[model samples]
Target: MTATQDSVSSLQTSVPPALSLGVVALSVADLGRSLDYYRQVIGLEVLEQDTHRVVLGAGGEPLLDLHGQPGAATSVAAHTGLYHLAILLPGRADLGRFAAHLIREQLPVQGASDHHVSEAIYLEDPDGHGIEVYADRSPESWAWQGGQVKMDTRAADIGSIVASAGQDTAWRGVPAGTVMGHVHLKVADLAASRAFYEELLGLDVVADFSAHGALFVSQGGYHHHFGLNVWQSRGGQPAQVGEARLLSASVFLPEAELAALRARLLEAGHPLPATGDTFTVTDPSGNLLRFGRKV
Candidate 1:
């Protein structure tokens, strides 16, 4: 096989073309603290907020919803729950601006990596929720082999990325094109998580890092729309109801695809609890997913 064909050979490269990830809802113990962190540190503007709930976004898009739970405890480590929510900037320069802002503000960064397809910086919220800010390289340059997209974790060139921020680079806030790109979750088992997201939800396993106990799935040949990892929560129970953690992740689909997904869930014996025009279901590891049409 030629070099390009060889790279594509081992990939499970089929994904439904009509799905897009939407807002992720989180439950937090102190709404005010979490709200401030996202606004000042993460550079999101508040779109809507009330005593109990706050919606934050950039350029009029809603990316996160925070619900206030006055006395809720922190999410336990031994739980099938969130690993992180990745915020995708439109370009590498935007990532540089954000990184420079973080450094100037003296915010703590957990780590960073060059995932081959993208560069990402990691941090934790006041509630211990993981957050990843990243920018994708051109798809033409992505590497693929062994039935999966190539991914590796190495120290990101932080100095170089930060240096990209010139006076022209403004850190007003998340730019208009910023988006909640993908979500990573801790799952009890990789096999079951793969079946749930791939067979049931129709995502393609673009990358599988079994050696690292993680898998990435996506649609339309993007690097990943969701990441499932067993690093921290292997063999863990799902978060209990009323826990201060991830609540539900929303996905928008065309009407036809929405109906087709409903049928698949029914055939799999999973309940589709509907409310108005939206329906929700719990995944194999108990994370809630909400699906609706893009009307």
Candidate 2:
């Protein structure tokens, strides 16, 4: 069972409410090429663009911001950086359409899995940045055991899902209700990562894959909002600024939740680096997470 099904009452008391993920920023080598890939392959509209940077999203909302650098190199090894940026679709029909589009275009799809809580399709961008397009299952259907959400990676029945599309609705673009669901990152150490995300930041450990060198945590227990893994980046350095790597990710919380987080950080001896309406913190793996309220 997932946390949403089993721990609603307890989560309401222990975790902060109204937490949501936001825009993920990246550094890219070629702005034009990355823009074309995101627009054509991923079906995202360019919300804003310039010579060096572009913000791409659906329905006028910004989800990904790509900043271009002339000599940037793409490297996954020797760096603790992004594992994947997950884009959550509004419904299964949307995922079906996307799956059909990928087949029609003969695009390279890496993998697809049923995660109990969500069904996800995995692929990569031109720069080899990982991407996951997924649709969550109903909260009531999710199961939980003990205090952890139950999640498993099984082969997705792509054929059946495509057939469910009904052949009426076509793939247009990312739907209006689409959102930046969660981000999975490769980190240096699981112990340190847990200290920052779970202990100091007060997120609930919804899934523990520590046996596989991974951990998934969330607030309010809908499943994981952030996934930390040490698969490829164990004991690696932080990603260089000029590389095509994850730059930052944002999380939205209410004012009271933010204040509570601040107090917790102070109590845990973590610094609060202020930036306008947001308070930014660097995780143990050096990934930047900015926490703020919705404006």
Candidate 3:
């Protein structure tokens, strides 16, 4: 059954309204190359680094963890894995500065879209892992109809966004408050994914784009925290180990909410081995999601 916001509220269990995304982990082919791309192009600062692993973020908060596996195969379109890791800038001005920086860098942007709720710019990392840097419109500006947010793809007003940068046009790095907003994944089946994320994980379906083979879910009344689509990955296989792809995405929840989710998973027959403060689960489509208590 397709889950709607009303139906989600009626569920016996639901993800805490305060739930939020945390750092996303990825496997990259070349540590050095990926680091350069993320730092120079994506504007993330290196927080910690070692030979095979690196942690990066903005404003001292961890946002991404890259694990290097030398000679790893690059991700393929047929693999059911990351579609994009979205970075949420704190404000539209930040996005404007970023947009101007990309222009100055002459980086090739794949696409730019105004989604009504937000404006997004899309690109790829050194390993072809997709990336989206965006700023959301104010919550009050968002439109809701029939328990679903009204969103569409339209050309973004780059000129207006650049103007929003105002006098502080210099591109320093992503400022404080930047975060890993959401993670979009390519899955083999939309229904199975919905069942896993909505039913088992308890995230509410905020939007259903079944006609486009996509679904979006979130906690609270936010537009979406996770986007699942089969646009190119229908009937696809999971990424093989040692391939450059998403390793996992983390979410933070209140302690009680985390415990409730754990119990629900256990009751539903999803194996969740005991972990200290955090636990990881593989969704039906093989996506790894880690849950931890929100501090």
Candidate 4:
């Protein structure tokens, strides 16, 4: 076995199966414009709003929080930061309805792909933050071999997805069950990221694409909660202060697990500022993450 595989097998702690992602916060160039795009194009409803910030989601659940910084620098492709924030639909029909909505609205889609385990459609916000809308096949349908779940990128069957919409093709909004599925990041170094997320944070390495400069980690046999890659950001710097970029992504875990993770972070010299019921830390590649007890 490769040394990396050995390291993955040796991980001692696994996060609880109930671990889940919460709201993803972003810094955007214009609050109003970003708000409109998210609501109209992405189909999220505003949960709360003010002059400088807006919280949006579906069916009363807050999924995204946008903070506006007037004249903020636009995010560029070379930065080591958010590659995309994935939103998972609860069913294939929901994905089909969303796909049809994009076509009906004439929105520019970045790409669509079938990753064996899920089918996804990609888009970019007004400020260039990447977004992914997807739906998974049943977990039992996934194929695993040699301790790794097999996944790949290929052309999505858009026609079939749209056909799945059946007679109810009208786009209302994202359904109640939509959620923040996973976050993909462009890191400066794969090995360093692996050490931070896999070894230090205690996420299990579900798939390691070291040859392609990418890695996937998760808990409880899910495909991935985090996708780390160096594709465009190899040796790149963090997003500058004014750049429209990911501000923070929140992870929810059991209180006991959170305490254990805090201990791990403290032992590794990562700072944990005092925060009630939650704490924030910066990863090795400068990504901000907030941890909280799952309620």
Candidate 2, TM-score vs. the true structure?
Answer: 0.94
User: Which window of ten consecutive residues has the lowest lDDT sum in model 4?
Assistant: 4-13
Which segments of candidate 1 are over 4 A away from where they belong? 1-15, 273-276
Question: How much does each candidate deviate from the true structure in C-alpha RMSD?
Answer: 2.2, 2.1, 3.4, 3.7
Task: Tell me the tens digit of each residue's lDDT in model 1 across 4-80.
Answer: 45655545544446677889999998999999899999999999989999999999999999999987777887899
C-alpha lDDT score of every prediction, in listed order: 0.86, 0.86, 0.89, 0.90
Q: What TM-score should be assigned to candidate 3?
A: 0.95
Tens-digit lDDT string for candidate 2 (49-129) = 889999998878889999998778886665998999999999898999999988888988899999999999999988879
Over all chains combined, what TM-score does candidate 1 have? 0.93
With candidate 2 superimposed using the best TM-score fit, by how many Å does residue 67's alpha carbon deviate from the native? 0.4
- TM-scores of the candidates in the order shown: 0.93, 0.94, 0.95, 0.95
Point out where model 3 deviates above 4 Å. 1-13
Q: Candidate 2, after superposition: displacement of residue 32 in Å?
A: 0.5
Clashing pairs in 2: 1-143, 1-144, 2-143, 2-144
Model 4 TM-score is 0.95
Clashes of 4: 0
Per-residue lDDT of 1-295 in model 4, one digit per residue for the tens?
Answer: 6543454454444788889999999999989999889999999999999889999999999999999999998887888899999999999999999999999879999999999989999998888899999999887767766558779999999999999989998888999989999999999999999989988888878889989999999987788999999999999999988899999999999988898888888888887875466999898889999999999
What is the model-wide C-alpha lDDT for candidate 3? 0.89
- Model 1 alpha-carbon miss at residue 84, Å: 0.1
